[model samples]
Target: MFAMLVRLYLTVAGLLLCSMLLVQQAFPYLFPDQYSQSARHEFSGELALLREHLRGVGIGELPERIAALNRSNPDRYSVLSPAMALRLPARVLAELAASGTASDHVSTEHHHVYVRLDHGDVVQISYDESDFPIRYIAYATVFAMVLVGLMIWLQPHWRDLERLRDAAARFGDGDLNARARLPGGSSIRQLCVYFNNMADQIGCLIQSQRDMVNAASHELRTPITRLEFGLANLGDTLDDRVARARVHALRCDVEELDLLVGELLTLGMLERSGPMPALERIDLSAFLRASTGVSAEELRIRSTHIEWELAPALKEVVVEPRSLGRAFSNLMRNALRYADGTIRVGAEAVEHGWQLVVEDDGVGIPPEDRLRVFEPFYRLDRSRDRATGGFGLGLSIVRQVIDRHGGEIHIESSPLGGARFVMRIPWHQPGEWRGRSRAPREEPAADAGHFEHSFHLQ
Candidate 1:
């Protein structure tokens, strides 16, 4: 704000300087004669001295300078006294001289002039005094015009600065939409344009974080209530095996709740700010295989067959290790949850970059629900809920992490009649593929016909 004010002041000062230059150019024409009244009095005295000096030198035939000099009546120059007469050429002296001019003794008080010729004649001259009033009005008009012009030039700049200050104040008060209007297509427009873009990004992040928290809280409420009710019922049970079973179920519910809260907190913190992205070259194929192994093992323990493949063209990428790990983990978990037969993880090189596909031979999501699944805590099967157990933040967290890394994640139907999750993280360069292949995605027969949206319940 201080800086903006300084700029505004400088702009106004420049305008004022320009106005001053213009006024100086028009000053003489607007105010006609510039001579002072005192200068005119001095001119009269010099004329009298010149007349005396000319007469002493025996050239007294010269006419006075100030002959009753009305241009309208030039045929008769008004006469003044000999003492007040100013010298001029002998030709002008003959024109102004007249006979019997004693009655025309021009008034010295009015600075009139009279002259006599060698023929003993005299003539008088005087000036009209009315031009001074017109000159005074013209001077006042010109001064007022310059002052008004200066104000007119500066008004727009002042208004623009005030508007900018008001917008900044509103933004400080949390009105993120407040924007300074930049006048004229100049550097100021560039500044305002950039500031507005920054504000828009900030608003989106803030609103997204708020929505995430609200949805997470709402998703957690049901499992928490169920946990509380189950515990209350457990206190009244007497059977050992039944109580143990109920307690185990309660423990699972508690763990699910804890997981949901932890994931939400992670998403929130990621929204606020996270570690700066460090770009390091890494073998992406190895990274995906290693990360998916943990989930693959867990699924295998349940006798679930999974397939992992790494393409020869799949190369390394420049990315943050932890964020990439998180995104890969989410994709693996989502596949593990619904895979009935096989889960295939592989990468392929494309012109844009590398495309990583996490495909499973399970029922793909309905077309309408695919987009909604990317939202936090938005589960498609309401019956399974959190008790059957995933908090539904898996895809959302995946998207967030990928977005931060400037990559894109896409969802579509797989060739194996299952969901296909495609992630494209641009490879750093050509010929960087480096990782061993795991087994191909396989589908088991037991879960074939039983595949439905409520696979967790089954």
Candidate 2:
């Protein structure tokens, strides 16, 4: 960490130092007015002054004055450039020859400038070094400190981001409990909250799935064991009454096993994937007739007052028939199980779609238990009440189907004081595929994975 930060700081600081040097060198040229109010030929100013000083001091030889100045600074020199010295303004040069010392800036600020000696040779002398190495050192120090401040601000954010990434990686690798642990006031606290929420939800779902699998296994073992024991001991109970009873019990066990397998496959299908969707324009009137017709015998047996309140405007809809049919069947069966003598099935148009309400005039679901009844294998009574209880996957399948159709199914208290299953499904106007027969979907592909409707024993 130290090495990496150091390297990064050095790289940034180096670049900034270089930029500072470039800007400083370019500033005087880019904006000349800002650097000076008027153009001053500094070299010429000192040169004119040198001649005046030399003549007034009665200096005959320039070497003597140069040697004397050299003793004080060791950087003074006089070169005989008589050819270049002649082009000066003679008046200014003559006037300056009467002076002693030049301006302080001309004497000290400039590193090198030429001066005309009374003998006409130009003297070249340096006052100060213009490299400004100290200024560059100061720039580098400030730049490094800025980089340090930036790193200090970024370090915590990097640590938080890295920790979040690691936690997500571990979660993806099946460590469901993995979570990003951040301290209070951390900058990424919101992101970590979302991640942890997602993790918790996924963990709960997986755990629920595991619980369902274990429950299914245990439930399945009972019927199989009963069948095995019944069959194995059948010969010993050779009496006619005993043999017949054993055979009946074995048959019941087989049916129970079949029912359990079917329900499991149904639930598995809903969980694993989406339904194969090929939409067609469905005549709601006819579709409802057919679906309810299949349950006519049970409805009649119970003498249930069946009422249909389908709106005339809700005549046709685009839908995947097989999936929709299953949803209707599950709701109808569920309503019939606990409904009183009257069952009301209604359909009406809503804002963006249609609403289907399947309610029965029976004991409504308890307020607190309505939501959980939709969960797989959850029983409201939690007793040995086989007549009213179901495999608990019915509403789950209903919800899954409605979800697949881009709709919502809500349980409500009906006008008739019973549990109402309300489904609001959208219906877009059919395209060219309206009323066209879709290519037949191959079965068994889904049959093995998919589960069936909720099963009620009574």
Task: State which candidate has the highest TM-score.
Answer: 2
Candidate 2 residue runs with Cα over 4 Å from true position: 1-246, 429-458
Model 1 misplaced stretches (Cα beyond 4 Å): 1-239, 273-275, 293-297, 385-388, 427-458
Q: In model 1, which range of ten residues has the least summed lDDT?
A: 449-458
> In model 2, what lDDT does residue 119 have?
49
Q: Per-residue error at 299 for model 2, in Å?
A: 2.2
lDDT scores of the candidates, listed in order: 0.59, 0.65
lDDT of 2 by residue, 52-75 (tens): 666644345556776776786686
Q: 152 in model 2: Cα distance from truth in Å?
A: 23
Give, for candidate 2, the lowest lDDT window spanning 10 residues: 449-458
